[model samples]
Target: VQESEIGTAPDKTSTAFIPKQNEQNVLNDILSSLHLTPMDVYAADNTCAAGSKLTERHTFFPPFLNSSVARTKTLVHISELSKLHSAKRVVSDETFQDLCDSIESTGIYLYTPIYDSVNPRMPLPLRYECRQFPRASGYVEDPATGIAAAALACSLRKHNQRYFETNNDIVPHHEHTNSYDRFEFYQGTAMGRPSKITIRFVENKDQHCDDTTAVKRTTTRMLCSGLV
Candidate 1:
């Protein structure tokens, strides 16, 4: 994952672009191909309901494929990762092939972020499932995907903007430093080669003089770490 991390220098942190997908038909097509109803895909932090149209689209380039198209990573809040694992086994090969052909992404990445405990202050951990369609290359289910992890991090920030702003008490902060959030993605478990990707990001920071609040500028820095 993330270009094998070995014998490679990490790239600089870059801005994450958050786009909107207003095409209802596109979302429907993707869900139809996987034999998954809209209920299978929901937003993180319970920001959106099942079967609702989510306009935010999170995309990123696969570090291994610089010349390839951007991959779209989606958050699937279907209660548990076991449900997705079962669905993946039942989907037809033809359906997956058609999905890859119809979509710009080379694969479909779905993940669920669940809180390990009932405490609200605890961090959320993610369980990822990635299916590389046969049409793009071969029908392979990757054990781990760094691209999806990065995209999901950005998506979570965007979807939880309100919660982050209003719930400042729960936001992790430090003296003489900007407040930030951390996310851990657990992947490859279904295939037995489990891995964990950790992402830490710093959000907007503003400064003011003479008791006047300055203009708000968003600064997002994403740092990723993982085990093979």
Candidate 2:
């Protein structure tokens, strides 16, 4: 009879797989096959300079916060947000690299928010999972970002208004609808660090309905727990 060793090896350990330059294209192709839609990009200026306080400590802000702590920072917008079953997901390496390049080229921050659409038990419409790239700091990802979240909320509000206006029927029926939009977001799982963020958009009743530009200016509040 042959004796068999059933126990596991004591020193067995797992190793991380690092991709090589030659295989990058193949890896990018595989990632691209995972059903990601190309996003529309836009540019905006950071309305607040609070990020200056953050940069004072050698910390970095999203590209939207601009490279410096100036009054207005350039912000890059990647709209047409997508939804995923889980917050933990991946995008094409090429897409990610392009985003990084855009940040370098535009000198702004990039924000992408993916959500879970099927979970009905959750009170919110969807669970927001956001990823932010800060190329200026030489970091590929930030665990969490309030500025990005706020920027996203602002973008969504503008999109919503445009959607209603284009429908024709909805606008005439509900002019100046004072509705509050709430969003709950999660981030940092991509880096093994988890964070939760909450965002709220409250439209000011005094907002000028006559001017489309005025409608773009709305109030947004963001709450989060973690280092942005």
**Top lDDT: which candidate number?**
1
Write down the TM-score for model 2.
Answer: 0.40
Give per-model TM-scores: 0.56, 0.40
Q: Pick the candidate with the highest TM-score.
A: 1
Model 1: lowest-lDDT 10 consecutive positions: 1-10
* lDDT for each residue of candidate 1 in 1-228, tens digit (9 for 90 to 100): 112110111122322111124534554555566556554543222232221112121111211111121364333334345555554533566766665454444566656545324343333232334332223444456666776677656555543554445545354444422234566677777677778777677666775545655666667677888986
Evaluate model 1: give its TM-score. Answer: 0.56
| Candidate 2 clashing pairs, residues 3+ apart or interchain | 63-108, 63-109, 64-109
Q: What is the Cα-based lDDT of residue 182 in candidate 2?
A: 58
Clashes of 2: 3
